[model samples]
Target: MPYPDEAVGFMADGPESFGTFTKRAYKLKPFEEFDIDVKVEACGICGSDVHTVSGGWGEQLFPLCCGHEIVGTAVRVGPKVTTIKEGQRVGIGAQAYSCGECKQCRNGNENYCPVNSINTYGSKWPDTGIVSQGGYGSHVRAHEHWVFPIPEALETTNVAPMLCAGLTAFSRWYATVPGRGRRLALGAETWAISRSRAKEADAKKLGADGYIATAEEGWEKPHLTSFDLIVNCANSSKGFDLPRYLSMMDVHGRWISVGLPEEEGQVIKAQNLISNGVLIGATHIGNRQEMLAMLKLAAEKGLRSYVEEIQIGEEGLKQAMQRMKKGDVRYRFILTGYDKHFARDLKI
Candidate 1:
């Protein structure tokens, strides 16, 4: 079978000016037996893309197209694949692949697989010797295992952000100690914090009895001693009084931080934990099992992602990235209007 020569979209070349992403083309890797080609219908813009392009995270490989929250139709499926047939509505999250034989993989924790764990973009594919591209382009070829079937009742745009941001929040919410009636206090910079009264909204969504927003003045004081768990999705480090916040948790409260702190060297004194019996931990992205479970929950609960739509053009992508940098999006942004040729051969 023949394949298209290239995909058209914006490509980032290290930390150059915003104009660097204009009118770029990237070569699509040769298809493999385990791959599923997707004609992208939507992709959510995420903060990680900005960090990668601006060199905020680290050195970035040039000629990269960064987007992970992808939703689309499976245009083609490899001969060896059986789970996802062509024409299936599907989505791919941040993680693209992992070595299936590793211990973490065996235990359903592919996100932490010790062997090569491929990211949706800006990461290398050890098996194919290709840099895994992303959903910013017209199409994406992902390993079948990473592709998830989008429920028939869900809209593509609404499900796009669930591929990353939604899943991140959901996974953390699910990991909290069950039956303890945990309360969540979201920090100020969380996307949820700024929109939708995050503390109360997420608390209700995650089955918490109550939540208090730390962003509002004097809101933190009344709720301090009422929570059993707190999840930090915001980027701030020093604004909150750590000792006081920790005291809010019950005797064995759990405090988990998911997003990176704005500044390095952010520290917490030992006395804070010692006096309050609070446990602090952090999480990376979800593994394959958690990813599947999250999708199931989203389907069952009618959970939807907040998203903005953008066209799949170079200028549109650049503008979307700029919006992401300024935190202008409500929760997520999904790219649409890609070429339709990739879906021509799909079979449902």
Candidate 2:
């Protein structure tokens, strides 16, 4: 695959009228010694993409092409990029560029490189000022460190979501590290919590032992001080009952939030933590080491993400975005058929 002068994709012109998309071409950031050019094969549609485009996350670059869970081929590797070879399958997640000299980067925490961590899309390159676009396009340019080689066992489309959604869920810090005996013996129970029981069957089928519907009367009483850890995945804080949820935590349990809702977050007070003394924290996307480990574990376990594939086009994108906003997707959605949508002259 030859590198192209312009990357083509469906761009949203404004947040006010976001779900609508238009096909357009945007220039890639200036090539750097450590950068790698990827010819995208598939890109997962993440909830964050929706938030950013709809102005939920905040103001963003206009006419933006939004996507972060990217899986593709290494079409061009800079001279200094030794880890990946041209034509090798690779993936890029949320973070694209991090200053390698930062203490966080040196300590295997590049995801938190506060000095200069660039997102896969929206963040502008320092010197070039070219906004970093994402996998909704035909090509993506990212630093070598941010790119990961895909395992042969994982299918391109199925593994795409793991770059973001899977990784985000996998990297959360669990308050209690259960011993191997209990983990292997299957004594620990799992439960799914939602606003309604409509998805109870689906949750059970996904291996949850029980389900909790918050809409039910006294939903929190029966499960009081029961859970050892709670990983919050709420996409909004509009009506979230923070104290009620925290009451379900066992003594000294932890609540780790991984979701980023565009709306204001629920407020917490000393009173909320004083009852159970539970800890609360949040995390960003996983680091590179975690990304590789996650991919390797998925490959070894033969893990597959639940994903619906949609062809790459304006109408397809529009439909996907609309459906995603309504929570119609079972798990994740991946945009495919790139070669059909992007012009052949672009050398995808």
Candidate 3:
């Protein structure tokens, strides 16, 4: 299939008001080496989308398109692309390109590539200097490295958010610990995903064997069981007292921080962890192999992302972002209706 000259996408004029999202037609440049054009079937609404469009994180490039968890069929592939051919079902996530020769890339840690690491949206191509648009559009074009073949067992609608949320959670969970094909952990330690009391059911629905209600004022509740691993996914560390939480950890407990707090710097005293030998580590998105493994595990186990689907349009996309800002969605949101909304009459 030939590439469309232009693509229509929902774009916000500025960060001042993301509710002002409107459909706009933007010209598509020719596919470059290792690029694949995907006719987007579904795209997930991630918290990053809200932060980028709402100016909460920072001022972004105006008229920005911001969906990253994209699942689609490949409509076009760059001439130099060899591994992936057209018509393949695939997914694209947050990080786009990383210098292949870098040590991080060589070690299969491309997400940490120090040179030329670019995002799926709001990033520029180092060579062409063209800005990268995301999947809140008819289609998306990305380098092969950031794209992965979607497992056949997964539904596009359900698996879309896995490209981001699943990858994020799996990377933190699976990176350090290796397990069997479906079993990710093998009796290592008792791990429970903590959440605000409001999301207690969601935490359980996501397969948490244990729950911790931390939303209570001063978190007046005490943990009955101590965990060896606690992955921090909180959006805010506003009143996060490191010592109080650290007190609940057993010796050699590791708190992996993956959440990006809107407000920076909740103090952590070294003494808090000294007695227990607790460790704090941070991670971003996962490497390519990890993404495939995550998808495979998800498929084999029939693990579906908890998502609410909304039509792909100005109102639907805009409200999804706004709802994410207010923590309205259960777990994730998927944008549907791109095929019908961007009909053949409209540029795609």
The most accurate candidate by lDDT is 2
**Models sorted by lDDT, best on top:** 2, 3, 1
Q: Per-residue lDDT for 12 in model 2? A: 87
lDDT of 2 by residue, 129-190 (tens): 99989999889999999999999999999999999888876763531145311221233588
Reference-based TM-score of each model: 0.84, 0.93, 0.90
**Which residue segments of model 1 deviate by more than 4 Å?**
1-5, 172-218, 236-241, 340-348
Ranking by TM-score, best first? Answer: 2, 3, 1
Please give the CA lDDT of all the candidate structures.
Answer: 0.71, 0.86, 0.77
Q: In candidate 1, where is summed lDDT lowest over 10 consecutive residues? A: 186-195
- The C-alpha stretches of model 3 lying farther than 4 A from their native spots are 1-3, 177-196, 216-225, 345-348
The sequence of per-residue lDDT tens digits that candidate 3 reaches over residues 1-348 is 223766678887776676667777765545788888888889998878877777767777667778899998898888888868799999999987888998999988899899888888888777667677788888788889889999899999999988877788778455555331123363343335454566666666766665666655555246522556666877777777777677666577667777777786677778767877877776788989989988998899888878899998878876777788778887788999888987763632
lDDT of 2 at 177: 40
lDDT of 1 by residue, 18-62 (tens): 535754556666788998888788888877777778777777666
Identify the leading candidate in terms of TM-score. 2
Query: Which residue pairs come into collision in candidate 3?
Result: none
Clashing pairs in 1: none
